[model samples]
Structure formats: structure tokens, C-alpha cells
Target: MYAIVNIAGQQFKIEQGQEIFVHRLDGEEGAAVEFDQVLLVDQDGKVNVGTPVVEGAKVNGKILAHVRGDKVKVFKKKRRKGYQKETGHRQDLSKILIEKITF
Candidate 1:
């Protein structure tokens, strides 16, 4: 079975045993998390979609580790005025393993 769920303001299609990276979440590594914002689910070609979220539907996962995304560099330069600026950023993230989905 596969499901579409909301995590950290983003939507993702997930399945059992699948690992995915999402915006950082609270709790420590090996922590168990449950997401109830399941938008849709498909089991053997039969689909169930919720208006906003499926009541009583949930996705269970385990927090494997906390990670950071690659740094993004931002640079700005102005003409002969000789004005330049540069910045870099990395997004905090979490790696999770989907354990199960239930409705």
C-alpha cells in the first residue's frame, strides 16, 4: 500500500519500508512518529481520498537520523559601485523510515 501524507508543510507519497527526508522534526533519533494527515491511500489499486485528511487514517514512522541539506550559496554584486554580498544556508532535515499505514 502507498499513501500521500503531509509532513512539515509538504506533501509526499510514501510506502512501507521506504525512507525519505523531510524538514526537521522534534524528538530524538529512533523516536517513533505518527502522521495523521493522510490525504490519500492506495491499496492494491483501490484508492481512498479524503476531503482534507482521512479520518482514523495514520502513517507510522521511525526517525532514523537528523541531517542537513547541502549548503546553498547566495551572492549579490553591484556595478562599479563596488558593493558585493554573499551568504550560504543549509536546511535542517530528518530521515524517516515508514513503518506502516493504517486506516
Candidate 2:
């Protein structure tokens, strides 16, 4: 089965045994997490959708590790002003492994 869930202000399609990275979340490695904002679920072609969220539906996962995404470089330059600026950033992330989806 697969489910569409909300995590950290983002929507994700998740399935059992799947792994994904999301915006940083609280919890340490091997810790467990559950997401209750399940929007939809599909089980063997049977679909179920909710109004905002499905009641009694939840997504369960395990925190595999805390990780950092690749660095992003931002550069700005002004013509004839001799002004240049450069910045780099890396977003904090968490790696989670989906364990189950139940409704």
C-alpha cells in the first residue's frame, strides 16, 4: 500500500519499506516517528481520500539518521558597482524509513 502524507509542511507519497529525506525533524537515529496527516491511501488499486486528512490513518517510520543536504551556492553581483557577494547553504535533513501505513 501507498499513502500521501504531510511531513514538515511538505507532502510526500510513501510506501512500506521506503526511505526518504525530509526537512529536519526532532528525534535521534533509530527513533520512531508517526505522521497522522494522511491525505490519501491506495491499497491494491483501492483508493481512500480524506477531507484534509483521513481519520484514523497514519504513517509510521523510523529515523534512520540525521543528515545534511548538498551545499547550495548563492552569488550576487552588481554591474559597475564593484559589489559582489557569495553565500553557501546546506539544509538540515532527516532520513526516515517508512515502516507501515494503517487506516
Clash list (residue pairs), candidate 1: none
The TM-score between candidate 2 and the true structure equals 0.97
What's the CA RMSD for each of the models? 0.9, 0.7
| Candidate whose TM-score is highest | 2
* Residue 58, model 2, lDDT: 89
**Candidate 2, 43: how far from true, in Å?**
0.9
Q: Report clashes for each candidate as comma-separated counts.
A: 0, 0
Writing each residue's lDDT as its tens digit, candidate 1 over 1-103 gives 9999999999999999999999999999999999999999999999999999988999999999999999999999999999999999999999999999999
Return the TM-score for each candidate structure: 0.95, 0.97
Across residues 13-72, which tens digit of lDDT does each residue of candidate 2 receive?
A: 999999999999998899999999999999999999999898999899999999999999
Q: Please provide the root mean square deviation of candidate 2 (C-alpha atoms, Å).
A: 0.7
The 0-to-1 C-alpha lDDT of every candidate, in the order given, reads 0.97, 0.96
| lDDT value, residue 69 of candidate 1 | 99
Q: By summed lDDT, which 10 consecutive residues of candidate 2 come out lowest?
A: 46-55
